[model samples]
Target: MTDNTQHTAQHWVATDYGDLDVLRLEETDVPAPAEGEVTIDVRAAGMNPADYKHIARSGDRDALPVAIGYEVAGVISALGPNTQIASGAGAVGDEVLAFRVAGGYASSITVPARDVFAKPAGLSFPEAANLLLAGTTASEMLHVTGVARGDTVLVHGASGAVGVSLLQQARLIGARVIGTAGEKSVDTVRRFDGIPVAYGEGLQDRVRDLAPEGIAAALDCVGTDEAVDVSLALVEDRDRIVTIAAFDRAEQEGIRVIGGAMPASATYRDGVRAHLIRLAGDGDLVVPMAGTYPLADALQALELLTSGHPGGKLALLP
Candidate 1:
């Protein structure tokens, strides 16, 4: 499975969309790429809340039996005839990472060439796998909110995967970030260069004290009512408040929302993907791994991810 070869790949399949109980390890034929596609021998895959949320809601649907991972990092195994990307200088067998696709839980995946980018030479497969979707989401959130240098930004759930990514990107743009996390995660937020405020009662007060100049913008990775309420209280303009989670209420509250069922425009998606790959390549992004599970133990992995409060991304190894 580690070497690039055309062979049957075993994948974890969710026979019915429900809880982790529905996920099963099953053997399936390895997929081949159509024109403008490349096949990957998946070395590592990243897991997120969206994986289980989609499974729970997709009950009895035909896509029910679909493969359930969105991000993977691996070596190119094969390329379809029309994939000119592999023919250019420094192409094919290039280690790469990709996002916004299915079938990443398997030993191999067929992805459109345009959806993939050459993995940074410095990152391990697991590290590269961790960056794709979460990094892109963070990038898009910062872009949409127009967060800029010298601005003070408040972020909720600041120690989670997306939160950490957002903190790093916001700092890169020269913003001073004040983030919320459980008391135990304060050190983690501090390590990321964010001012850590314990999340709970008095969150708004803590943020106000941390940034006496006032919060110019807010990004919520945590969808709790507390998170939404605090952001509304601190930022002067609702347009500067963005929630990656609370899209349903964003419009009513006048906060900007990005990355949910609200489809990302192609231009924004491309820009975010490029920034993520570049950050990984430049060593400016760090994706901590909470744990790793064998492909056979995928259900256990999903259970841990859905359990909530895990500090970093859960990875699947084949």
Candidate 2:
């Protein structure tokens, strides 16, 4: 067994507030898990636009050296006394996935065990790592909008990570999804049982044509002027429309907007993690894999993530 007391890990950090150039990889000591914590030898780290977005928008100079990445899947290397995983009891060597943790873009990480749950055996490390972040976001979006069986949801940016998860999750609950995507992602939309609608010119009219009875809710994953305009035009009930993006438009237009940074959103997302884990483990929900990148190539992976055509979920293999 590897010595648990000593671990030298390579992790990525942003030394300043800027773009990818601010990201610097440096070797650091992995401290042993403290009270109510666990140390993980990370096999895979989930990548999202938020990973880079947070860094790019960092105006706080004091928080300059914040670590990157939010979720990871790996084996527990060490655990604090009297601590238990969120799913229940756990031990060193147990395979687990953690979300909403910091510094996950590393070969190893020590995080509060409360947020960690056992990785489903059916899922690969990367898939498990990719599961909760987007799943929970999709869940929150649907929850806020009160999406239910037989209801129709209008999803903007249905081909992306959150979008794909939204499509599948909505499908599982018997809600029909009319998803907006580029011409290339029509198959991606259909594969997840979503009705594909191409974005751009005539988007509003096309969505109207697809759901003439009217959209039950509009979930905006991509914050585009077009999405906001179309959603406003189609959905009569303002409170039923929500956005994870389009924060400014949501404010100006009096629509709902939620993000991980918000306390209420964080609480809701955390509360639903176990459910999402169960869904993925039971094979009811499948996270579409876009691709993986080496730990050293975080920038490249993030570049693809920001490209707006990631195809599906992306991960960093540590």
Candidate 3:
């Protein structure tokens, strides 16, 4: 920040709203953080499907060339006057992680200090960068569904990032989880202590075979009708079923849907950041990373993400 004009950064942006082909790796001036903000020298950027989803959905020319990526783990390169991070005071050279940030797919990012947090020593940069978004989402699903100790919950797409988080967090809450995964992902579900049931035509019967005691709630991380139909059939209490993606299905079926885009969900997710990060620090929660790619290979990473079998979370090492 000593010489504001001298700082520059390489970042990913969607010059137009479309597919991955429209994205460009471009250089831009790194602005000095304004009051209550700080600039970070990013070490890693977390990858999520949401990152690419935004790029193709803006549908507005004015919002063209929007920055991509939402979270990062990095070092504080500069601090604004009187800036304080989400956890407390921040300092230059402090290792940190930030969520709800723009342009995180970069070598550096300047973001609001309010979104920055002290990175846990137990988490590597890749893990720290990938924690908050999915972790918070999973936490909210469990919270809204009234998942409690001794409760058995069914999670669709159990091997996904959010599902993995749900399994770990639910374990901490003393709730037993029955998770649905592909044959290849069965071990991953089991690794997280979830009863792994292979998902397909016989998913419901398979789930019933594992949890004959009855499922107390259902979490739909996958948007398939099978997820919705099975959840509706198993959990008579519609209030106990929730989906993060199937908005229309939720409306039709009267099941709940939660995401960062919803006001209540956003508030809850933000409020839980401190607690979730602490859990990661204490090793009560583990972020399973399937892969990491160079910053410039964000598209390739996105391709794997789009493949719907990433195995776990993905991160971009900058």
Candidate 4:
């Protein structure tokens, strides 16, 4: 009898940047762990716009056949040499979730041990896979802007995955959040402890009415010009205004931008992953799931993400 775990694995890859047609499913040998790495039998993979956007934005990149994925949750199947150190190494059968990994859209993956964390009991595999990126981004946004207890902040796209995380994490920090959302999503933002304000013309005045003292900080998850303009007018200090979506305008407007694509921004997100995992496991943070798809149908998942307003995060189940 042969070990099925060592058999070929199926995964999605982008040979070049293009539309949904660019994503192709392929089979390859199951990966073996190198030093300080662990192989996981993936149960769930999280989907985000960044996954597709990263490919679409690349122009004639040298790397061909790039494995496309960022986050996954699964059980450890094997550990690499010298990985057992200080009782921190993940053992076989350990349920774990990891972020910032390549080739996550597969039945199994080998990732660095340092990037893996024990899956929080309070969350299912899908939620655990979804937790790290948005949660850490929210945490970093709050930290970089100095949002504290008794402070009021503005969050654009409050009902989005990252926006919802922002609302929950900001409330956890004891800050009051005034969030911009569509008319239909007002209650969704409110449910996350955010005061929802409709996004449209006169958004600045509406936010001002809600926060008479003015917002201490503003975070734009939507990356709209309106959001940036409103944030600039309301916040006294430009440093307190940040955009995760509008990186190009950040320098021109003299406001900070935190994005995974930016070299300087990774430190803020990487530093907070462990703390975010703890918070989610403790039930202080929640990651809402919009939908889940079989691994082979990842094209539909990417299409749904690009469609916008899916109401929550999408996950891939192998």
| Candidate with the greatest lDDT versus the true structure | 3
TM-score of each: 0.93, 0.97, 0.97, 0.95
Q: Against the true structure, candidate 3 has what lDDT?
A: 0.92
lDDT of 2 by residue, 1-318 (tens): 223486799999999988888899999989877778889999999988888898777578887688999999999999887788888888889999999899999999999989999999999999999998899999999999999999988999998889989998999889999999888999999999999999989998898888887899999999998999999999989998899889899999999999999999999999999999999999998988988999999989888888877878888997
Which regions of candidate 3 fall more than 4 Å away from where they truly are? 1-6
What's the lDDT of the predicted structure labeled candidate 4? 0.86
lDDT of 3 at 38: 87
As for TM-score, the candidate ahead, 3 or 4, is 3
Ranking by lDDT: 3, 2, 4, 1
Candidate 2 has a TM-score of 0.97
Scanning candidate 2 in windows of ten residues, the lowest lDDT window is 1-10
- Model 1 scores what on Cα lDDT? 0.80
Candidate 1, residue 237: CA error in Å?
1.1
Q: Any residue pairs clashing in model 1, and if so which?
A: 96-119
Residues 58-124, model 1: lDDT tens digits? 5558556878888888888887764744224225577887776687888888877777777878888
